[model samples]
Target: MVKWVLALVGYFIYRFPGAIAGYLIGTLIDSSFESNKKSGRKGFDTVFTTSRSQNVSPSDFELNLLSLASIVIKADGSVSQTELDYVRAYFVQAYGKERANATFKTFNDVIKNREVSAQRICTYLNSRTRYEVRLQILHFLFGIAQADGRVSSPEVSQLSSIAGFMRINQNDFKSIKAMFVKDANNAYKILEIDKTATDAEVKKAFRTMAKKYHPDKLQHMDEAYQKGARDKFQKVQEAYETIQKERGF
Candidate 1:
């Protein structure tokens, strides 16, 4: 309809030689407007699709995280308010206050249903998320397990199972576990070194571990994941310090 009206207007104007220029000008204006309108609709569709895709990605990530947390919290055959509180604080710290309540509700729903498969969730995350990001999530799970000042055997087992499903290396899994399991006694274990190693060897181990677990290495990650890496980084630093202090280095 608009095109026909524009054509008729152009035709009438073109009938007067003096106004031929006017007809051409009017046609050009109409054509430009029509082009812009189509482009505007295309731009809107692109933005809408991209926005929806972005929203789905983050929600999937959050849901998977909450599911894994529920698995860890319930692994000990019971739940503690302390652990729940720690998880809530973790969510708030990672996503900010605006998302805290909604995330907690999702956590509650996952726990209440009791049907969420930790293996499946971990598998999905392992495939979709970056390797370092998955490692950070494992670090966060350990923090949750230790929130009550103790990491129970069942919780450790659950963690191990999750790591396996995530395809995390056995050595990497043990190194992260050492950071949280204080009962392991050997700071060397945390650094993935032998107790009989020379001072030089220990220093090298510390540096290597430090580089591997440094939060700065993960700065490009989501803020929450970077925060989780910070916890691991601190533990690695503590372990190195303890070894140095004990050995009089």
Candidate 2:
């Protein structure tokens, strides 16, 4: 039915040149919805736009840290080396080698520091990046996670949390998350509990996860294992928060 309607509209445009003008005007009106949402400019101002302001600043650690969380999401509730490697590559490009390496190392330290919370990651980034840039960064994360042609539940859960921290609309977040989930399993599924899990359950899960991925255990393994452990551990914390929102606890 929609296709038929579109075909009829096309025929009308083909028959009447004046219809082309009307069609263009309609397209402009339709596009205004998105523009209005972006600029917070409404019916009148959008029609007669004034000089627009622009801000170009690099995204802060918060954005990077949250983006890093997306890669840490896994199928078995354990992040894999593939995810860590992706993060390393991303920061290397985003921050450049030397600064990116230092920033990456500092982020790992912060995750391991046991003094900072995942919440701080968003707070820090929110302070540093423009609202539009934060959204773009979040979307870019979805792109990275999907680059391998597969996305897991843990990643989706983390993406949802990051979106929440950014105050992104639920509908919009779902739309973006959907773009990356081309295969089976999702972040919520890997967590093995619904969003409605009780606070006690969340705590229990976090503790079990805490012991499993603790960097301390990986210290005797190899440098790679030890280096990745802390970041993976931080992901466990993020997973717990994802559950928290579902339960409203």
Candidate 3:
């Protein structure tokens, strides 16, 4: 990201060769900074967040997320304290404790009483965020649904609706859903491959899924967001290993 920004500046200021030099410099800086961060010498960007929604304020993002969580918690006809606590804890970890508390307060006072419109919210979100980020949000909602240890039928229906509204394709929705709602040892389903897939095809699917779910892609968000991503990434790895063990290859 730094490289791209600097390379663009260099292109304007000094042409093609300067762009190359800028990129080389930016690479070193990015790498050194990443190393410092990993070693705990550097800290999180004090900026809590800005959504891809450039026009809307960032607090809208937090409010919408809490609204979605509320919808999921109430989907099963009764709210579970466990699910509510799970959402709070996740926010506390992903954002900060103060921000999470304020967001939840706003949800209760403003968004929670209104009819939750998944379609309207998703239409607003789909344009701003990348497909990958929406997928992560869907995964997070599923985490909420299953926080009490089981996803109810109503919750599943609500999740499916949200996924559709977010424009998540059927296959991607099924793949994530399989993780939260499992039956009959469905590793193949989780991988979005068939039991009869060729070994090469299975391997190919696993690689694609692994890359898609990699925590590095979400590293800019926050530690908790990356940790959530790792949950999905590990599931991909586990499915692959199960298949590999079964096939003995």
Candidate 4:
């Protein structure tokens, strides 16, 4: 996070003395991290898991997710480096860098080489995780698919299969899908409504979806996780506003 802030500040002040300030601060922060590297490694366990992300242990969740991610990356019959980096970056942002590094070491050394069963993984998750968390995971997967610019047909098909295994509702799945795939009726699709629905029904659907995708559903996770959740929530808001503007309501 500090790295991002320093980079942003440096970008804005590239021609000014403020860039010097950012560089100095980043140097100090980097040195501090180097000195505390041992403690950071030792402290990975505490930040790796939160008691609030369902009853699934951190290791279990990380393993299952990496397995699924590997499947998604291979779905298009070709792997893209951008997609791989998106997954790595997401983990680094959501968990601290130390724990994310340990998890990815497992991912590269073991999980990526195995044939994982989506059925077993989803069954475990479906039984253990809440609907909201499952939805968030689906959203994350879609983000991965879109990382390389477009969500391909094969990736969407793979995601659909995964969502089915996870017991995600078709309408709910479509709602998230519409966020990535542009279409004329995306606003209606996002709220799980139809163009023929009455204005009252549109308003009702807005409220329903607003509650479903609210960022508070992910309050227990990292701010990065909640920020991702807010993307969905914000999509719902934008969809509703789009409909209202169209209908002049």
RMSD of each: 17.5, 21.0, 14.0, 11.8
lDDT tens digits by residue: candidate 2, 47-102: 21213432212222323453345334342355445655676776565445654454
**For model 3, how does the per-residue alpha-carbon lDDT over 1-249 read when each residue is reduced to its tens digit?**
555644664565568986776576555445644665577642233232237424432344665777788889889887788998898898888766765665554344333345678888888777677677888899999999999999999999999999999999888898899888987656887788878899999999999999999988887776777888899999999989988999899
Pairs that collide, model 2: 153-186, 153-187, 154-187
| 59-119 per-residue lDDT for model 4 (tens digits) | 4566578778887887898778898889889888876676566556534633344567878
Supply candidate 4's per-residue lDDT for 140: 90
- What TM-score does prediction 1 earn? 0.73
Candidate 2: Cα lDDT at 107: 40
**lDDT (C-alpha, whole model) for all candidates:** 0.70, 0.49, 0.76, 0.77
Clashing pairs in 1: none
Ranking of candidates on lDDT, top first: 4, 3, 1, 2
Candidate 2, residue 229: the lDDT equals: 55
Q: For residues 1-249, what per-residue lDDT tens digits would candidate 1 score against the true structure? A: 223433353345444552444344444434543564566522111211222253223434655777788889988888877888888888777656654555465236446445678877876665455566678888989989999999999999999999999888887898899888865455878788878889999899889988888888677555777777887778888988988898899
Best by lDDT: 4
Better of 1 and 3 by TM-score: 3
Model 3 TM-score relative to the real fold: 0.76
lDDT of prediction 1? 0.70
Clashes of each: 0, 3, 0, 0
Q: Provide the global lDDT of candidate 3 against the true structure.
A: 0.76
Shift in Å, residue 241, candidate 2: 37
- Model 4 weakest 10-residue run by lDDT: 41-50
- TM-score per candidate: 0.73, 0.41, 0.76, 0.77
